[model samples]
Target: MANLLDQLKSYTTVVSDTGDINSIKKYKPTDATTNPSLIAAAAQMPEYQSIVDDCLLAARKQLGTAATDEQVAAAAFKSLAVAFGKKILEIVPGRVSTEVDARLSFDTEGTLAAARDIIAQYNAAGITNDHVLVKVASTWEGIKAAEILEKEGIHCNLTLLFGLHQAIACAEAKVTLISPFVGRILDWYKKDTGKDYHGAEDPGVESVTEIFYYYKHFGYKTQVMGASFRNTGEITELAGCDLLTIAPKLLEELQTTEGTLPLKLDASKAAAMNIDKIPMDKATFDAMHEKNRMAKDKLQEGIDGFSKALVDLEALLAKRVAELNVAV
Candidate 1:
């Protein structure tokens, strides 16, 4: 009997949701994703110190002595992200998701510029946009930015998505992929009602199921990747999703356990289900998003958390630059 992880992979594309290079080698997911949080965490590990130090040195040399500390630090932060992304790309044959600055979640032009800049950095390193997925928060502006970039041959991964409205918007924008957080949704419901939930009854599972059905029912091409899972059950429940970005811990659990993982989500099954197609225009999107408190709150929280992680990475880089300067 195959492990549950292998069983799940038969039905869905598995994505490693981490910046840890060792874990990526161990799990061997089809694709891998990294945000500020994962990168920041990896930067703190002794094994990854050289990666961060090398990027910091390159960033300092590129900016020269005239650049301010903030400028140098910002340059290094972006460099570190791309540096990690390039390494991940080397390991995964499919695609690697590198996220934009979370602070630009509401700025369409800003997000667009950042996406282009990141893609340019990747290209300079001999990696094309086809191997990269620029991850953006699922704000209206972020969706708009994705829409513009998609037409220009730059692919996007709409992250921190929590609602059907966000999924609909991404589909309408023709974005490359959308990551709907399954565990985070469950966390919100658990905190709100103070009750534990599991399996099919979990709010997170229900949310992804609904979005999966909606996308397939409407014949949308944008991929729906369930993410931020809390348990193996959540991952199993979403077995037949387009993709599943899972953390290392859950991946290990699935790998060690043997079970019959049934396919819970099938596009063909979704297409046959009775589901209504909603027009995802700007007005409708905003209105519907406003009505879903859990989605709205979680989206903002995810952005803020990622922004903080970026800030922490910048501070760490600045400290490293200072230490190197003192040694000189």
Candidate 2:
């Protein structure tokens, strides 16, 4: 039998979900994803210190002694995103999904503006759209922003998606890709029922399976990439998704294990499933959004967490900028 990673790749495109270049290089996934959390973690790594230092130097050069910590932090984030994108591209032949500020999830206009800024930063660094997917939250506003961005030839990866309404909205908006969080869904269900889920019966696994079958049945062009994994079982359960973005820890587990990793999902199986394709208008979308409690709470929670992290990162950057000034 082929290696499990190779076998998994045969059906689903594997995406590395971290800013750690060494891990990505080791696993050699087809694509990679990065967000504020991952970038912040990478920024603290000694090996990636140069990346942050370079960004700090550039910010100082631009703003001189008056540069605020927040501004410096923004520059550091941009610098780190671009640096990660460059490294990811060298390993994955497909694309790298880099997220905009989660703080902008509810602010459609702000999200659009930030996405354009991120892409421009990448372009300035010689990375093109052909290898970049700007990650946005799957909020109604975020989807609308992505819709417009896609029209301008910028592709988006919709993340933090939990509900079918989110997926339906992304499909309607014609997003480049949608990351339906698998592990998070399982977590919600586990908490709700106060019982552990197992194997294919897991709610998280079932959620992605439903989304996958629906996308195929309706011929939706938006790619489905499962994200936010908790364990190897969640990863294996979603074996045949369009793509699966995994953390470095899980990737190492998969790489080391030897087992008969069979094809759990296929186009033929998806095609055979009889599922009604419900077209989502504003009313239906709103109703569906309200009904899914897990999706609703999680979306809000994720946005809030990401927004706060961005603020914290900005504070850290500002302190660094102040130190640089004092040194000069």
Candidate 3:
């Protein structure tokens, strides 16, 4: 019998949900995703230090001698994610999701600018946009920005998505992918209801399943990638999703566990269900956002968390650059 990992892969495209290259290599996921938090964690590793150092030096040179260390650190922040994405692309045979600054979640122009810069950097490195998925928060503004980017041949991954409205908007915009977070949804429900959820009953699992059914029912082309899993059970429950971005530890569990992983989410099954389609314009999106407490709170909280991680990474870059200068 095949292990769960291999069995799961036959049903869904597995994506590594960390910036650690070694973990990605061990699991061999089809794709990899990195957010500010993951990139910050990987920056501390000795093997990845050189990637950070190179970004700092390049930022310094680009800005010239008039630039202060603080300015260089700020400048290097964007490239750090791309640098990590570039490295991840070398390992994964599929796309690598490099996030736009989460601070730009509500700023359409700012998100577009950051996303363009990220893609430009990858292009300069000879990595085509096909191998890169610029990740943006699934705010109304973010979705609109991605809509524009998509027409220009840039693919996007709408993330921090907690509700169906966000998913529908992303699909309507024709973005390449939407990352509906599974574990985070469960986190919110578990805390709010003060109860435990397991197996197919997990709220996170249900959320993705709903979105999957909606998409398949409407015949929307935007792919759904179930992300941010808390356990292997959550992972198994999402089998046959378009994709699942899993952390390394859970990937290890699936790799070692032997079982018949039956397909839990099938497009054919979703298409046959009686799912209602929600119109997802900015007004509708806003109305839904205001109505869904879990989506609103979790979206804001996820942005704040990622922004903090970016701030910490910038501070680390500044300190490392200072030490490098002293050594010279």
Global lDDT scores for all candidate models: 0.92, 0.85, 0.93
Ranking by lDDT: 3, 1, 2
Measured against the true structure, the TM-scores of the candidates, in listed sequence, are: 0.98, 0.95, 0.98
Compare candidates 1 and 2 on lDDT and give the better one: 1
**Separate clash counts for every candidate:** 0, 1, 0
Per-residue accuracy of model 2 over 1-328 as CA lDDT, tens digit each: 5566777877789999999989988898988998888877787788977777778888767776576667776677666677778867888888998888898898999999989988998888788887899999998889999999999989999999998889989998999999988888888988899999988998888888888888887888999999999998888888888899999898888888888887776767766778887888778888898999999988888888877877776776677667766877
> Which portions of model 1 show Cα errors greater than 4 Å?
none
Can you write out model 1's per-residue Cα lDDT over 1-328, one digit (the tens) per residue? 8999999999999999999999999999999999899999999999998998888778779989888767777788877888999999889999999999999999999999999999999999999889999999999999999999999999999999999999999999999999999999999999999999989999999999998888888888999999999999999999899999999999999999996889898788765688777877889998998999999999999999999998888898888888777776
RMSD of 1: 1.0
Per-residue error at 187 for model 3, in Å?
0.8
Model 1 pairs in collision: none
Cα lDDT tens digits for candidate 3, 94-182:
99999999999999999999999999999999999999999999999999999999999999999999998999999999999999988
lDDT of 2: 0.85
